[model samples]
Target: MPVIAVLVLDGVPGHQLTAPGLAFGTAARHHPPVAYDVRICTAPGFEATGGLASFRVETPWGLDGLADLDDTDTVLLPGHERFRDPPPPDVVAALRAAAARGCRIGAVGTGTFTLAATGLLDGRRAATSRRNTAELARLHPRIDVDPEGSVVADGPFHSAAGVLGGIDLCLDLITLDHGMAVAIETERQLFLQLHDPTTPATTCAAYTPPGSSLAPTTTWMEANLRHPLTLDDIAAHAGLGARHLTRRFHAETGLTPLQYLLRARIQRAQWLLERTEDPVERIAALTGLGTPANLRRHFQRQTGTTPTTYRTAFRTFVTNLTPRE
Candidate 1:
């Protein structure tokens, strides 16, 4: 089993601190017989002060309780309220030592700041919340900060964009360790819809009010994703002129008709990739992308990876997870 050490600091966001446990723990439960052991660790004098508001949190383990870096598989750093300030020297030293010992390090939200301060991210790509991207880049000029990605992994170091992005990062780690099936099952248990990491949060919002003007047309588009769809077809289905439909769709969905269609198609393709073993050619045809080449181009642009690579990685992970009879 992998041992995960979550380092807690003063003013740490409660959600970030708990997210790793929830993700890994839930995944382990679904997989049967636990696969990971997670523990919260802090320095001897550490006292928990909640972020966003002042509240108290208590933990059972101190820094002395941590296993040697070689024994610990990963160390998670959760973002604290005072992210602008450098972490205590002891914590920084510990993290540096852990990295040197070949332990994987993960930073959640502004926890990237703490990780960057150790110079481990000096020449590596990292991610932080979009709101703090400029500051992160300005502070660490040698580090490549990706503003658009929700989670970024370069070697043994992984960084997540925001509080919720911590979940994405943990789920990704679960996928890497177990497989797509386990990750998808964990997501279902958590009541989360699997989303493409590269897609912006606003673009993934599926909020359509009951009486919204675009609801009916949007419904039709989903049902016809396998067909060769055109803007005119959407307009005709909605009983409106093409020009009028475009305007209303934009007003209601915050996306043009074509943009919404593309998003829908991408989502459908992701589902097929996760749930079926169909070849790229068949998947492309099923999702109305026309051909394998088109799917590769668009899927790479949307998710930052090729279809074959995605399938191989996910399937291989899952295959390793199957228990022996």
Candidate 2:
């Protein structure tokens, strides 16, 4: 069994910490028994800091209570908002010690900042959220950071971009150490769709913060994925002109209207494939991807697997074991 230590820093992004906890924690609940032993470790005397919401939280054990590097096989770091500021020397030292002891170090989103601060990322290829790319490069010139891809592993150091990408990275890690089938099953159990690194910015850029002006439009796109929507139609729904809609969509969500629509359709296709035993053509029609050939082409381009292969390999292994009745 691999004991995994998740280092949650002060002022960490609440969602970042919770993302891995949900993915890996759910994975640890597998029926055949999971190989991971995960724990959340905070810095000594660490009081919960304000994150996404106005709330305070406290964990049971602090840093001292964390399993030593000698005992653990993997150490995970979730992102913190304070990436420019240096971590405490003791915190950096502990991580370095873990890395030196050959424990795999994993960082999600801006947590790579902490790793870079410790010099662990020197000469290493890693990844961080696309929005943080320029600053990350400026702060740590030695590390090779890929803003496009989801996960990158340099030696034993693994990293991922975005909150969702962390799930993909963890699954990839488990798959590499375990097996493909186990990873696929984990994804099934978690209801996680494997992110397509090849899709460029459609899904990633389509994401918008809540309360943003474009959120309503994004929601509308999501709801209408199965419908053939033109840019004029989308603009009309949002009560805006095509040009204004395009600009606003780009500014708020970092994606154009068409890209967002395609991603929504692709995401829907993925869900239908995973959850239903419907034929590929039916899934395609439901997701607005049209014919089975079109569905297979797009699905394969995004997921590196054909629709039939993905459904056969993933849908069968998931529990909850209900046939389409």
Give the count of colliding residue pairs in each prediction: 0, 0
**What digit string (tens of lDDT, one per residue) describes model 2 on residues 1-325?**
6777878777776665666666677666652345566777887534564455734556665665344656348888887657677888888888888888888888888888888999989998889887887788888889888967468988989998854537778887777765443465566556533463322211221345445787677777777777788999999989999999999888765678887787667767766776777888788888788888988787777656777776665544443232121
Alpha-carbon runs more than 4 Å astray in model 1 = 43-45, 52-54, 163-165, 192-325
* Ten contiguous residues minimizing lDDT sum, candidate 2: 197-206
What candidate 2 gets wrong by more than 4 Å, as runs, is 192-325
Q: What's the true lDDT of residue 282 in model 2? A: 87
Model 1 TM-score, all chains together: 0.59
Q: TM-score for all predictions?
A: 0.59, 0.59
